[model samples]
Target chain A: MVSEADSDEALMELVKSRDQDAYARLLDRHMGSIYAYIYRMCQHHNDADDLTQETFLRLWSRAATWKSGQVQLTTWLHRIAHNVCVDTFRRRGPDDYAEIDPDTVAVTDDVPDDDRRRAVHNAIANLPERQRTALVLCQLHGWSNKDAAEVLSVSVDALESLVARARRTLKRELSAYQREICT
Target chain B: MTADEFADLLDCYGTDSVAWPSSLRNEAVRYAQVSDEGRRLLAKSIAFDAMLADSTHVPVAFRLRARILERIATNESPAWWSWITQSMWRPALLAILPLVLGFVIGDMTSELDGDSTDASMFLAFTDLENFVELNESTATDD
Candidate 1:
């Protein structure tokens, strides 16, 4: 019975020893974030759910592989989630991704906020995979640029570039909505 | 910071001033405070950021925790012996077993044959000694 106050590293230590309670704790701590991250990436609840489970399963099985001093657990988990998404993308092929056209988004002021948000969601889901990932990590998830870069396996500069490009696209796509909301 | 520089910072680091690089944060805030265009861009960024944040309401993964816990419960790590028994090397060792046994058996048989060969050589040497002794005795008698 690991205490609730145990650090992620401490929980991971117990998980490495096949402690199910520690595994459960880590799951509760990370599963939502990982699931959301995957959901944002893949945009399919079923796939995101499966991928999140897969990510945690890897955490449970590969607990010993984690180097506590070298990398934070959240970064490591996100990295795993990133890889899982990549694998899914590879298997599903490029055509499976339903990229929503920016022009098709209802940018009119008369559109309801929910519809505008849906447009925003489609716009994000339609961004190039790397750009979307960078934006999701840095902007949506509130991860530091450096940490997000680590998860994306790119330099901080490259990650920043991805994020910048994503924001530019989003701003362009959502400019009308931005005006409407800001007014 | 110039308008383009300020917008770039917002684009890269986001609307949150705190999330901006420390060196740029104060300058960006100052620029937003002083410049009309900067303020407009900042406001737009803030609004866009709010939209982006609110765009996707991630629903709580229904029963995901229970499903994951169930999986963890079912998929216990294999024991140490299972690591060996489940490995490719198991088949490889099985394939080499006959050769290893043959080598050992052949070595034992060779050792037995070597002893017999040594005995035969000793018998042949003894026969030669006996023949020499008989010949010498016959010669002595002659």
Candidate 2:
């Protein structure tokens, strides 16, 4: 049995050699998270799909030049995904980000009760883009402040500020419920 | 404690500050223990954290998984085939087509020229004259 790390390196080697199995495995391992990330960023499924394909096509084309470095492959992929999302936002006029479907936006199932999780998910949807990405990376995805900063290409202090501002914003946004719930 | 003071505590609450002034920790604790408002705020913050902790997840759609994999497979199959074909045949083609077309056209013109013996050349000139006459007469008839 191959360890995941070993498998990842092997798959990357295969990917560099244009192996379909490797590409499929890589996609299988990451598609859901990648899709969710892109979906959150773009707020549209079709657009996410398009961006996902474009991301992979880029990876496929550039596979030959991929260097083994300090950054993990996941982080590399996230950077590419981030750039793709940014390009999409640039191409689509600022006002053209489609409104997220309530059902899709609130599809989280992390909480014991799905309904409550959905509520929190909806609240997350209201966060500004930087805050949303920071929150998703640090709070939801369990990334360390340093790791999240690396993924965002921000300073650790900057990421800390993003998370801090995000938490305060969330607190204020949910202040109405503070009285009833905390009472 | 004033909200400003309490807010500062909240910001530093998660940090591992070895240098966190003992005075600040005591003040925050005293506030949490005695002030109803502070207790309420702490509980609210805890709930907020829990909501975040318990909320986000990547929902895996099996159909979408299959579809993406299928797309990758289809895309790669064509590329793989092209790669294989290019590897096996491209050099051979590069070496062969120009020579082959050159040979074929050369052979064809040579055969035509060979077939044009003196007698046949004369026949060709007569045929051209006949074709011109026939076209002129047809135009006149029209």
Candidate 3:
């Protein structure tokens, strides 16, 4: 049995050797976080589920690429998940809930409280693919700028810039929404 | 140091102090306490964080895990290429087997030259030396 104390590096080594037990342990360890991150990025439960499975399936085929001391296994998995999301979006359009960066947050007369939450989600979803990815990994998932940059395959400065642009967009949209709500 | 710069950090990083770059957090906090604009901007950012916090907790179905595990169980083994890697010595040896056999045969032919009437007969690669001699007769004729 692959124990909880066993490092992901150790588990991955065993996985490389065709150990079923090690693969299962790794699946159990990472599935939750991977699912959540994918779920947030894609915003569809079924797609998230498929993406999560695909991510691990990818790990099996691509296990040799993961070198220890270079990145945390979790970060590598997220990178896979990120690619899956980008590919999915490229294939199909954005989820309806978050179609575009909703510059105006259309509110005429009736303002239900739910609109704020929806607007935030749409704002998150509508971010350009890379910016959305950077925001999800760094903001929602709590990855550092460096780790997030490594996963995104960009320099830290580029990542910081994506994050800055994403936040600025969100801040501008939400600020407008806040003004609309108050007045 | 400036409220505008700190506000940008707040916009990028949100309300969480941990999210802010460590070098700037102290200066940011100091600025927030002293600057009216800093405090006001943080309050707005906090509202955004609050809104995000509500919806991010998407609970995945527990059964989803079982499906993933089952898929893993169905095809549970290293890739075909891995076998070539794990027992790499086997292929390495296989590659040199022809060379090793040639050297052994050469050594044996020279050493056993006087012992055998026909060097080609003994030198032919087959377990049954007589069959090798017969096969070589045809090979040499060709």
Ranking of models by lDDT: 1, 3, 2
Against the true structure, what is model 2's DockQ? 0.15
* CAPRI grade, predicted model 1: medium
- Please provide TM-scores, in order, for all candidate models, with all chains considered together: 0.81, 0.60, 0.73
How does residue A45 of candidate 2 score in lDDT? 61
Write candidate 2's Cα lDDT for B5-90 as tens digits.
66655543332233234667777777877988777666766666665564555444446656655665666646666564535466
- lDDT score for residue B48 of model 1: 88
**Model 2 agreement with the true structure over A1-183: per-residue lDDT tens digits:** 868655766788788777877887887777766777776665556777777777777666566556666677777777788888877776866576444345533323332355554455556666667777777776656567777788789997787778778778766654443333444
Candidate closest to the true structure, highest TM-score: 1
Put down candidate 3 lDDT per residue, A1-183, tens digits, no spaces: 756458799999888876768888888889988998888887778888889889988897678778998888988998998888788888886554446544437644654556766777777878788998888887788778888999899998899889889888877766656554444
True contacts kept of 1: 0.82
lDDT of 3 by residue, B33-140 (tens): 898988877777766666566646677656776787778778666466466554546579789999999999998877767657465566764458778788999899
The local distance difference test score of model 2 is: 0.66
Q: Over 4 Å off in model 3, which ranges?
A: A1-5, A93-98, A101-104, A107-113, A176-183, B77-81, B85-142
- TM-score of B-chain for each predicted structure, in order: 0.57, 0.34, 0.51
Residue pairs in candidate 1 whose N, alpha carbon or C atoms collide under 3 angstroms: none
Q: By descending DockQ, how would the candidates be arranged?
A: 1, 3, 2
lDDT of each: 0.86, 0.66, 0.78
